[model samples]
Target: MSINHDPKALQNPMHVRVAAAFRIVELSDFEARVLSKGYVSREDYDEAYLLYAEKMTAAGFRVEHLLNSQGYYVPNFSSAARDALVAKGDPAEEVAKFESEQWTTIQNCELGTFRLVNAIFHEQSQPSGQFDS
Candidate 1:
């Protein structure tokens, strides 16, 4: 399925809100918001995570959630780290190894929206005269 990628085209307000939040916040902060008290239900968290995974994947990123010892779900946004896991050959074995290392929980989220947000943030962070015309 083709993802719209356009924020304005999103029908769910929560999806739009989550996408907007990701634009200005770091991955940990974003996860914090979702895990905040009374922010959303368990089902809602799953939905929001699905959207996050979709957007990250669209931006050429892999989504891996790590359940830290502090009981917080942290997202691994490092491409090099993900690449290292991929280099392990078998998908099942790689996941097993990764989970055994530090994370108590490891989930692969590869559903489809946030390429536009990533692009906007990337462009804004570029120095003057550094952007390709």
Candidate 2:
């Protein structure tokens, strides 16, 4: 597949679609679509993500490339907590290592549950009656 070297082409819907497809869909589905259409490939996804990271960084956003649980390179938006941890003498690598060591499957499951419950409570507490039709 020929690579588009133009940076403006990164704004093309095809690039966004390809990147979103790879990120959100199952691997098998993405691969099947690529094989059937020949419009985009895994390389396209990587290029699109790279372009996005570059653009975001140029705009002064700190984009940290972190490995997801599936071992894929995912871009994480910078957080103040991460910055504070780094400022306190713990290197980013050390913080990542500590996070990996402490973030177990059970902890992730509990966090998911906590987030869901929090969302439900937040929704319930909203003034829905004010917007009643």
Q: How much is the lDDT of residue 12 in candidate 2?
A: 34
Q: What value does the lDDT take at residue 34 in candidate 1?
A: 35
**Per-model TM-score versus the true fold:** 0.31, 0.30
lDDT: worst 10-residue window of model 2: 112-121
- Tens-digit lDDT track of model 1 for 15-116: 345446444232343333433332344444445556766665555566686656743345666454546676766587776676564232222232221232
- Please give the RMSD of candidate 2 to the true structure: 16.1
**Candidate 2 C-alpha lDDT tens digits along 11-117:** 33443343343342222322333323434433544544555456555544466767667434455655455457778999778999755643442233322122222
Clashing pairs in 1: 54-112, 54-113, 55-113, 55-114
Off by over 4 Å in 1: 1-39, 80-133
Give residue 108's error in model 2 in angstroms: 30
